[model samples]
Structures are given as C-alpha cells and as structure tokens.
Target: MDFDALRRHPDLEAPGLAAADAADRLILDESASALAEVAGPPGSVVVIDDAYGALALGAMDAGARGVRVHQDPVTGERALAENAERLGLAVDERPAALPLGAGLLAGARVVLMRLPRSLDRLDEVAGLIATHASTDVRVFAGGRLKHMSLAMNDVLGRWFERVDVTHARQKSRVLVASGPRQGPASDWPRSARDDELGIEVVAHGGVFAGTGVDIGTRFLLGVLGDAVPDAATAVDLACGSGVVAAWLARERPRLVVRASDRSAAAAASAPLTAVANGVGERVEVTRADGLEHLPDASERLVVLNPPFHSDAAVHTGIATHLFAEAARVLAPGGELWCVWNSHLRYRPLLERIVGPTRQVARNPKFTVTASARRAASPLS
Candidate 1:
C-alpha cells in the first residue's frame, strides 16, 4: 500500500500536513499478525481514530476484510473515504465507519487504534472494547513516542489483564493488550454541577473539557446574555459538551437552540448536559461537520469557540473554515459571536469572511468578537 500517496483533502492541506505518518505505518506493521488471525465475518477487525484511511485501508490491503472503523472528526472520515476511492479499493473492501458503540466493537478479534491525546478518551475506547468485544480480542494501540505516556498503559491495564510495549521504530510505539477484564457497568457520560454558572456539565470521556468549562468558554459565557437579544433561533457551532447551547436555552426562554459538533463524544454528551440543566427539550444536538447540515441563510445568530488546532498541529485554518461556515449559515444581517485566542488576531479574517467585525470583549489571553453577515458578500 502506498501510504505516502494519501492526501488530507477536504481538510486543511498545507506543506506539512500529511494523510499518514510514522505512527500509522507502525500501527499497521505491528498489527499484521493479529490481522492474519482475524476470522469469520467482516466485522472481526475494528479500527479506531484512523487519521485518513491508513490503518483501515492498509489492513484491507494486507487482505483483512470487513474492517469496521470509527473516526471522531468528520474531516478525517471524509478524508478516509476519499483516500479509499483514490486507492481504487472496491466497495466491499472499504471500511465501515461506525460510531463508538457496541456495533463498532462487538465480536471483534482484533482492534487497531491511534492513541488519542486524552487519557479519558482512551479509557472510554478501552472500556467499550472490554465490555463488548470478544474476550480474546487483541488490541494494538499506537502513537508517536512524544505523545505516548506510561499512563496509557495504566488505563489499558484497567480494562485488560496485560499490556506490552513494543520496541520503538521511527519515533513510534505500540501497546499490545489482551485478556479483557469484566468490571462494573460503564460509568460514562459523567456529570458535575457548575454552581457559578447554575448548570450541570455533562461529558463523555472523549469530549473536550470533560465535566467542566474551559477558560475561553467561561469568558464567552460571561457575555452571552448580550448576543443577539431579539433573535428567535441560534446555533452553537463546534459545541463541545453543549455548554453554550444549554446556557442559551436557560437564559432565553423563547430562543430555539441547536448544538452541533463532529465528535461522537460531544454529540453524546451535549444532550445529557441539556437534560442535566433541565433544557433538554429546548436544545437540539446534532453530530455533524461544522454546520454542514444547516440550511443556507437559515440562522439568525450563531455562537462559536472554534478550535485552533487540526489534530496536534496548531493551525489557524480550522477557525477560518468555521468562520466561513458561520457566514454561510447566517441570514443577511445575522451575526456570528465568536471567542478565540487573542494572539491569533482573527478580527481581520472574521471581517473578511463574515462581515464587519467588532470587538465584544478581550483580556490577556482571549478575544471575543461579533461579525454580521453582509447583505451581499464575495463568499456568499
């Protein structure tokens, strides 16, 4: 398989951005033995967080069939499909992208994964595999050496009886684990009360800022009351854990609130957050690629705390993409309220992409801005 030929298109592609990396190659190489061991139906092999189609496609290229896959980012999901088509893999040879649930884990004899930065995220994946997968399942989790930690072995230890570290290769390593442990029922979708904000924060392991508000989100909340006071409907884009959507519904009794995110964890956590805050009926949660599911010129206002990174690499292109999406979704004269790192100086980009941008609030670390949709714009 030509891993180097894969491209991260439909994602932010730059000179340094890659569709596959050393960690991916190492994972494929390390999991080859287990791949040959997979038997029976197509679902016997499972892949998680495949950056593009490297792990899944590579496994398929190695002759493993019916690979079930799950990627948290919609961009990665699209990239995988595009790469598969580009590689000329047959329809039956392509991997099935599934959500992080029983269907993705059930009856799996082998699992390949890219180690997530969040230990909680890893814990969740490990727990699901332990509970739902075959007792003899062999797990191969790999990542760059810089991103690997001893704590991951501890997390896997909780779910599996043994975890063995593989020798380093090109700054990448893999953790092999077998012997699933039966434990107490899963304790996911954790929740905690935020007394200051008067709401409950619900989170699954993979969701950002699990069970708490980040400083940027906290800053956004402080000024949220003044965001488009007359608008009847609003959207919370990149809505992690749905803190903003839940807050909007509680503050504005008449406002229709929608929370959308690409992460399965965030999608699962948001509605729970709404229910915990007693706003479940008012907040609608959707797992989607940034407002792609939204109709053009359909929203009066949108709130965003756009992510600054594409995976581990810090890139401003993600925020720019969100700003453009916000502009497309907002009706003429509608507004986009956003919070970002002050140093990024997104005001100029916001002005160009959305409309006339104005500073809403600012501190040493963060800047909050409002941009209105132009009655006519170049991008629109």
Candidate 2:
C-alpha cells in the first residue's frame, strides 16, 4: 500500500504535516504477521488512534477483515473515511469506526495502536484492552523513539504481563504486549474542584490539561468576565472540558453558552464539567471541527484559548484556523476574546482576520486580546 498517498484534509494540511508517516508504516510492517492471522471474524483486528486511515486501511489492504478503528480527533475520523473512498476500498472491506469502549476491543485477536503522548491516555486504553480483549490477544503499540519513553513501558506493564520492544526502523519502533493481567476496572474521566476558580473540572485521559487548569486557561478565565456582557448567547470555540462554557453560564444565569471541540474526550468531558458546576441547563456541548456547526454571524461573543500544537509539532496553523472560524461565527458587532502565547503576537492576524483588535490583558507569558468583528473582513 502507498501510505504516502493518504491526505490529512479536514485537518490543517501543510507541507510539513503528513497524513501517514514512517511510524504508521513501521507499525503495519511489524504487525503484518499478526494481522494475517486475523482471518475468521470481522473485528479480529482493531486499530486505535490512527492519525488518518493508515493503520485501518493498511490492515484491510493486508487481508485483515472487519477491522475496527477508533480515533480521538474528529478530523482524523473524517480524514479516514475520505481516504478510504479515495483509495477505492470497498465498503465491506473498509474498517468499521468505533468509539474507545469495550465493544471496540471485545474478541479482538490483534490490536494495533499508535502510542498516545499522554501516559494517562495510554493507561486508560491499556486498561480497556486488558479488561475487554481476548485473553490471548496481542497488542502492537508503536511510535517514534523520540516520543516513546521508559514511562510508557511502565504504564503498559500494569496491564500486560509481557512486553517486547522491536528494533528501531526509521526512528520508529513497536512494543508487542500480550498476557493480559487481571486488574481492577479503569478509573478514568476523573474530576476535581478548582477552589481558586470556584468551579469543578471533569476530564477524560485524552482531554488536554486533564482535570486541572493549565496556566494559559487560568489567564483566559481571569478576563472572561468582561467579554460581550450584553450577548444573550455565547460560544466557547475549541472548548476543552467546558471550563469557559461552565464559567460563562454560571456567572451569567440567563446566558446560553455553547461549547464545541474536535476532541472526543473533550466533548465527553465538557458536559460533565457543566453538570458538576450546576450550569448544565445553559451549557451546550458539541463534538465538531472548529465552529462548522454554527451559522455565519450567529454569535455575539466567542472565547478561545486556541491550541498551538498539531500533534507533537509546534504549529500555529491550528490557532489561525480557530481565529478564522471565530471571525465567521461572530456577529458583525460581536467580539472574539482570545488568549495566546506572548511570543506569537497574534494581534496583527486578528486584525486582518476578524476586525479591530486590541490587547485586553497581558502577563509575562500570555497575552489576551479582544477583536471586534467587522461587517466585512477577509478570512485568511
């Protein structure tokens, strides 16, 4: 299979960003024998966190039938579907998309996973497989050596009795784990109270910043009180765990706040946070790509603490995409309140993409800006 033929559309696509990498190829090659053994059942092969359709499609191409797949980000999910269509993979042969749950792993013979960066996420996933997958199932978890660590092996040790590391190929390696250890049920989607912010935060392992507040979000929360006071409805674009949405709804009793994120974990955690904070009635959460679900000029206020990284790479394209979405979603006189790293200096881009922009607040590390939407502004 030509792995490089895959495209990362619906995701930020740049020359530097690839839909498939050496890691994906290395994983497929390392697991080729195991995949070939998965002949009888439809879901005998399971692929987790495939950045695109690489692992799932590759498995199907390698004669693995009924491949089940789960991807954290909605863009990755969409990209996989589109890639399958582009590659002319028959509907019956394409991988079945599933959520990260027992059903996804039940009766699985071979599991291929792209190792997640977060140890918490890895723990949760490993726990799920150990608890649900077949007793004799083998897991092939692979990633670049630069991103892999001894800590990952330790995490896997908790669930699997044996873990064998494969030799590095093009800076990528696979960890083959078997002998599932009987263990306690997973305790994921943890919750904690932030006394300083007077809010309860709930999070799944895949959520950014986990259950505690990050420094950047803390800074943004401080200035949220002044964002478009008269707007009856507000949006929390790229909302992670619904902190901004919950805070807005709690502070303004009558305001209707909608929170949207691309991450499945964030979408699942946000509503729980809202409910815990006693703002569930007014807070709406959606799992979507940017603000695509929203109509043009339909919102008066939007708050964002945009992410700067795409996977492990430090890319500003994500932040810029969110800014353009905020501009499109905001009403003519609406405002976009955003907090970003001080060094990025997004004021000029905000001015060009949204409208008149001014610095609202600034700390040594973070800068908060307010950009009023212009009736007509070009979206870059």
Candidate 3:
C-alpha cells in the first residue's frame, strides 16, 4: 500500500480516535501505537524491527533517526530503506539487518517492537534485549489484546523492572517496559533428539510443536534420506528456522542446501540455525513467496513441509501454489519431496501438477509424497 493510503486508512488510527484524529500519525498495529506513545518521541537513535516498520516510519517523521533491523533480505531491506527515504530520515551506519540473537543492539536507547507470532523466538529477542539494553532504556511492545497472554507479560516482567499495559485502543493494547535491571538469563533445554542428525532441537515458547519435532517433518525426513538420489542442489521450501535444510546439509555435505520462507522472522532465524549447526557455509536462506525468485529447473531436489494456513485459517491454496512452484523449478529427473496432513487431499492435486505422483510414506498425522517433473512437450 502507498504511504498516503497507509496514513489515511481508518484501520491505521486508534479505535475511537480514527474519525476525530485522522490527521494524527496513523499506526498500522496496536503495538506500534503503544510503542510510539511510550518511547515518547524518538530521540538520538530509535531501534525498530520488521514487525513495526510503520511505527518506525512514524517516529522518523517526528524527527528521530530510525534504525531498522530486518531479517528478510527482500522486503526488509527494501521497505526500511524506501520508507526512511520517503520520510526524509537519515539512515545509520550500523548494520541494517541482524539475526534474532546476534547481540547487535549494544547501545540502543529506545526499542519499539511488535510481538512476533513465534513466542519461542520472542524469548530469544527478550534475552538479547535484557543483555544489551541499559537500565534507562524504554521498551514499548504491543499486540492485539486477543494475542496478549499472561505468560508473555510474566516473561517481560522478568526481563524488565516494571511493566504496564495501556488501555485497549482498536482492540489492541500496548505494553510499557523499563529496563536496566533484568533477571539472569537462563537456558531452555532441548526436547527432541536426533543423534544421527547431530542437532539438539529446542523450542522456547510459541514455535509450532516447540516441544518436539513436527510429525509431518519427521516423516518427510525419513523419506528424503531414501528417495533423494545423489542430490547436488536442493531447496527447502518453507524452511522454518532451517531445521530441515540444516539436517539435509549435515546428511549430505557435498549438496548445496537453500532454505527459504515467506516470514521475515523465519528468514532471519533460518540462517542462524544453519550457521549454529555448522552448515552455514553450505546453506543459503532467503525470504520469498513460494519459489518466485528462483530460476526454473535450478534445483535437483525441493523438499517442502507445506503449510496449511493463511493467517489464522486453514486453507489448501498455499499447498497448491507450493506444488505448482516446485513443478516449475525442478529440472528433468528432479524430485519434489513433500509432507502434508493426510486428510488434506493433496495426492490428486500433486498428480495434476507434477504428473504420476506417488506416496513415499505415511504416518498417523501425515503423508510423504514424491513427484518428478514431466518431460517438456514437443512444441517447446
């Protein structure tokens, strides 16, 4: 959406104030508004992340030098730069992008954040904030009231000295936190084990199946080890936190593994996971919708644990699009290995797109399937 559109849209204003204060800074999300209010006019340096770019832009408009840390190379880089330039704000020389726990914010004064959907990853960010921020730093966080959990408040309280909530504006509330003094950091234990894989997988709070590896992914991994025939180039479509691609790279050191996801947060975390697991040199991660940016027939194997949700609702269109993209990007004799909920009815769709799809394995929760792209038509 255009900047003018974002500013003028009623959805961007506080709930009751939209009509009365249309000319006021329009915040796209509730957390952003609360952050803007608590930070109280960003001075000197203002730190923001992908979730609250609009709020950052608002702060920049109000005379703050906004520094945005984005994980997604595509949207993150483009949006932050373009938005800052649009508002006639200066960009800082410090790194424009950072992984979730890279300890980059050593001297940030005011941090404005929008709570990410992945709660476990949020804890990691909290730990980093606790370690790096000084006592007087003001951290303003916000989210929809529906999404705010007491557990999150408790976690924030542990990291900051005092925490308070703003009244609901547009069905969303902002959290105000004062830092400088925080509880000692503690390590959360890993729950899943794959001794052969050599990775200790742990989930902190809000990751999907954070306590253990996902059953569908486990099934897919089993089939992948057997089905892939000397794969030299591989792509892990929807590579959340790089677990699948990391495992793939560890299993086949000679293969080039590429991981990608649509979420900016996932893109940031995936590369870190790869590097932490000693596969960073071999794995490349990017943020893109499906396989939009990759060339045709570029990879030998494309593994996917396709998602079934769009926002909060379950839908099949995402899986369908992923299959179409996989078919488009696989070379002749290239394979697409995918795991899906067994009840999702993907077998027929796979056959329609890739032709002659076959079931590779099955478990109570999911089905592993494989397909080879059909030979080109004679006309081509």
Clashes of each: 0, 1, 4
What is the number of residue pairs that collide in model 2? 1
Model 2: CA > 4 A from native: 377-380
Between 2 and 3, whose TM-score is larger?
2
Residue 277 lDDT (model 2): 94
- 1 versus 3: better TM-score goes to: 1
Give the Cα RMSD of candidate 3. Answer: 6.0
Q: State in Å the error of residue 17, model 3.
A: 22
The collision pairs in model 1 are none
Name the runs in model 3 displaced over 4 angstroms. 1-4, 7-52, 71-104, 182-192, 195-198, 202-211, 250-254, 262-293, 310-321, 352-355, 378-380
After best superposition, candidate 3 residue 207: deviation in angstroms? 5.7
Candidate 2, after superposition: displacement of residue 25 in Å?
A: 1.2
Model 1 C-alpha lDDT per residue in residues 1-380, reported as the tens digit of each score: 99888998777898888889999999888988788777446788999998888999998887788889999888889999999999888777789989899999999999999999999999989999999999999999999999989999999999999999999999999999999998876788788998999989999997889999999999999998898899999999999999999999999988889889978789889999999988899899998888999999999899999998887888888898899889999999999999999988999999999999999899999999999999974783
Q: Could you tell me the TM-score of candidate 2?
A: 0.97
TM of each candidate vs. truth: 0.97, 0.97, 0.74
Q: 291-336, model 2: which lDDT tens digit per residue?
A: 9999999999999999998777788789889999999999898999
lDDT of each: 0.91, 0.91, 0.64
Q: How do all the candidates rank in terms of TM-score, highest first?
A: 2, 1, 3
Which one wins by lDDT: 2 or 3? 2
